[model samples]
Target: MVYRGPYRVRVEEKDRPVIEHPNDAIVRVTRAAICGSDLHLYHGMMPDTRVGMTFGHEFVGVVDEVGPSVRNVKRGDRVMVPFNVYCGSCFFCARGLFSNCHNVNPNATAVGGIYGYSHTCGGYDGGQSEYVRVPFADVGPSLIPEWMDDDDAVLLTDALATGYFGAQLGDIVEGDVVVVFGAGPVGLYAAKSAWLMGAGRVIVIDHLDYRLEKAASFAHAETYNFAEYDDIVVHMKKITDHLGADVAIDAVGAEADGNLLQHVTATKLKLQGGSPIALNWAIDSVRKGGTISVMGAYGPMFSAVKFGDAMNKGLTLRMNQCPVKRQWPRLFEHVRNGYLKPSDIVTHRIPLEHVAEAYHIFSAKLDGCIKPLIVPSAA
Candidate 1:
């Protein structure tokens, strides 16, 4: 699949990727996911998203070939690749901050390398094709547990891990009231994971009723349609006895709405980095000294966030590109024990040839689409 421009993607035959570095491996991609962050590129919201680039970060595949230096994995190994590309020995990687590794992205001043993201994120080709070249194969890709389902393995690459990390960042205490903004895949996962972290009450806010219903069913959380509430912040305060939630999560990131000016200036006009509405709302709706975990994807540009309110309220802001590989141990346990099933959120599965339609449906929110998986080698 290649990105042509905003709202455009095409599946075309391309040269098969080969192992370029001694630490690299060639993986035959079987399953890949269309992440919500990919929408930023699909909508032209992210900078330097060039045409002809493949856009996928969540994928699982079988190792087709391995470079001479690759040791942990060999040909024919089924592996789940993490979204972040790191050298494993970098300063950040040593501290388990693989997402911020220094040796991967040439533009490392901003962020580490991410597969299939824009040029700002290292310009690596993604795994939405039949084959993908995985660098630092030993540390970045994990062997899929034999009992794990393919659908679940693919999600672990990004969405599920990101959501789990978001909840972990909240530092939730027992009986804490947690509010998550956005009912997309990450939001739902955060809400569900919050329960595992001892959240007493989880509230998911979104405009779509279908997503809200999924939040309730999948996450076992209360739901609210932000459109129905005159003031969502006020509504949250009212429910929290005017003290506000113990933790507020900004899972909606840049494309959040409910603010006309912010929407126009940020999303529509591109004057600012993606809209800061959800982050600001999280700030206003969290209690003093509470925490805010940002799992949403934001562009490299500056966003007009409510730093004053956050400071005045003494909010502990925790955020980062989730270290996908780091979260696997606990997540694997959860999956094995049936604590969570990441694949439950999949609402559409389309062959690679129909990826363009899949993108359109997901972007337009048509047919109650929640998550869409891409089968690159489907017949």
Candidate 2:
């Protein structure tokens, strides 16, 4: 399918993507997904998304061919592609900071470039098609063990990795109390990561009952519907002896209303509040000297940040767009050892032809959608 225009995905006949560079590989996509970030590009929210760019970034595929220089993967190897393509030797990659790679994103991001994105990347096509060209394939694609299902491997591409990043940034540790501020896939995964990394208590706050329920079961996170409670801070105090959580993750970025106030007015999902609201809540809801990690997508520029409140609390704030390459290698060990069941977060399976409909449902939360995985027509 081709992103012929905004809010569109039309099946088209075209040559499959090939291994064009010395370090590249070609993979036949077995499972591809529609991500929350894809929605931004679909809605024309991404400044770099352009017409004709194949739309998808999450995938698990089988290696069909490899460039001469490729060393690790061979034909028929099942692998999951990283969302961001990067050169391992770049300044960012050399320092274990893969999101800011100088070679792949010299002018913009420091570590990486996404497939299927337009000018911001190298205009490389994405895995939404039958086949995809993988840049720096040996360094970017992770071979999935035979025992793991494709669905599980898929999460390693983006959501799970992103959640892991958030958890790591938030300083989640043994016996620490952690609160994740969203119940979306990434939020749920963040909560899960906290527990995996040994948090003593994990709490998740969201208005959606279904997602909250999912968080409770899969992540073992205590759920609090923001709608039921009049004072969220009070609820947190009741649970944590009024000291608040040890760490708060602002996974619901730039979309709500309460950056300065402790009180939050309930609004529909993806509406009303933005990142500021969650940041403010994190500040108000966490203990003094606690950590705050923000992983939700936000624009490049900002008007003002409440440095005063953040400083006064002595909160250690860690914020960044995901650097998939940095985390993928470490994550592979967890997946291999059966330490992470990241795929449990998927709540829906959709098809490519029904992508537009699926998008509407997932975007509007029309159904009990958690994370809807999209299967291509050919597959």
Candidate 3:
């Protein structure tokens, strides 16, 4: 699929990718996902999202070729590639902060390189096509475990890993009450992960009833439709015995709803850098001195956030692009023990040719589309 502009993408024949670096490997994509972040690019929220660029960051594939210097993975090996494109020896990567690697993107002062995220994120073509190049293969591409399903492997590339990282950032204490904003893939996964971290009660907030129901069934957490309450933050406080939740997670970014003025200035008019309503709600709903974990994607521009409230409350705000590979080890254990099934969240498997339709359905939240997979071969 190729991007033309906001709300426009079409399938087109493209040149097959080749190894451009000694450390590179070429993989034939088998399963690629339409991530929530992809919608930002689709809606033209992020700057430098050029036309004709492929947009996908979550994918799993079979290695088809490798440069001479690549020895970790060879032709015919099944691999899961993390979205982050980084050199393992960089100062940041050496310390497990792969998302901030200094050697990947020319503008390394910002977040590190990412696949298909636009020029701001290194402008590498993504895996939405049949083949994609994997830079620094030995460092970022891991062999898919034999027992892992393809759907599970692809989810691990981004969504599931990001959720686990969000929970980890929360520093959840045993029996802590946790509230998660957004019932999207990351939110649901974060709610489930909070349980693993010993959260006594987890609540998910969203306006969509289908997603909230999924939160109840999939994460086994209480669900609240924020639309029903005049003031969601106040309701959250009341439910938490007026102390607020021990931790709050904002999994929604840029295009949050429930605020007309914020939506008009941010999402509609493009006067601000995405909507900050969800972040503000998370800030107001957490207890004093509590932690707020942000796994949502935001532009490099400004938004009207509740910085004063956070500072006065002594809140610890932790956020960053997820280091997908960093969270895989522990996640592997959780999956093996039957505590998580990442594929259960997958609701649709569509051919890449119909990605436009798939995007429309998901962006509109139609028919309970939680997660959608793009199968290139099926095209």
Candidate 4:
């Protein structure tokens, strides 16, 4: 997938990636996912999203080649690469904060390197291509367990891990009431993970009915369509006995729709970083002193948020890009135990040739595309 600017992408022939560093490995992608975050770049929401950039972060592949120093993985090994590109020896990585690794993306202090995102994320070509150059192979890529389904392994690379990380960030305790703002894959997984963490009740809010249905059946959570309520926050408060939810997770980011002013200013006008509707709702819907976990991706610019209310209410705000590798062990157990099936959310399997159509279908929300995987080689 080559980005040609906002809403313009095409399948173009590109050179196969080669080992560029001693720690690097070349991966021939077999399964790559089109994530919701990719939509930000697709709609031209993030800064520095240049043309001709590839746009997939969640992928599983076979190692075609490895540099001299790579001993953990070799040629022909099936591997699942984390979205984060980190060297593992950095100060943050040493503390298990892989997403904030300082060595990979020295240019940006706010975030670490990421594959296929843009120049802002270390300019690494993403795995949406047939081949990707994976830096820090020993730290980032793990051998795919033979017992795991390929679809499950691919989803574990980012989506499932992120959702589990989001729930962990929320600090959910036994019987906590959690509200997740979005019914997309991340939100669905967050809701499911909340149960594992002992959440007494999980409520998913979205505008789409199909997703809400998925939330109900898949996550076994209560579902609400925000479009049905005149004041969703008010309803949330009432439903929670006026105290509000114990935790609120903002799973929707950038292009969220709810307030007309927020939508126009953030998405259309390019004045604010990204739409703050979901976050603002989270603040209003959570109880005083409740926690808010932000798994949603926001831009580098400013956003008009309800900072004063958050401060006054003493809300505990915890968020970061998921340290995908750090969350894998628990996810592996969860998947192995049959507690989570990450592939259950995959609604489309598109070949690389139809990536443009896949992007269109996903961006347009047509064909009930809850999740779409790109089959790079059809292998």
- At residue 100, candidate 2 shows an lDDT of 65
lDDT of 1 by residue, 32-94 (tens): 999888887787666677889998999999999999999999999999999999989988899
Whole-model lDDT per candidate:
0.90, 0.77, 0.90, 0.89
Q: Choose 2 or 3, whichever is better by TM-score.
A: 3
- The candidate 4 region of ten consecutive residues with least summed lDDT is 256-265
Give the residue spans of candidate 4 off by over 4 A. 256-271, 377-379
Model 2 per-residue lDDT tens digits across residues 104-197 = 7644753257777655555667776678888888898887877778888888788998998999999787999999998888898889889778
Worst 10 residues of 2 by lDDT: 261-270
Q: Write the per-residue lDDT of candidate 4 for residues 184-235, one digit (tens) a residue.
A: 9999999999999999999999999999999999999999999999999999
- In the predicted model 1, the residue pairs found to clash are none
Q: What are the clash counts of all predictions, listed in order? A: 0, 13, 0, 1
Across 1-379, the per-residue lDDT of candidate 3 in tens digits comes to 8999878998999989888989999999999999988987787666677899999999999999999999899999999999999999988999999999998888549699999988888989998989999999989999999999899999999999999999999999999999999999999999999999999999999999989989999999999999999999999999999999999999997672224654445445555457778899999999999999999887744557999999999999999999899999999999999999999899999998898998898888888899999997542
User: Candidate 3: which stretches are off by over 4 Å?
Assistant: 256-271
Model 1: runs farther than 4 Å from truth? 256-271, 301-303
TM-score: model 3 vs. ground truth = 0.96
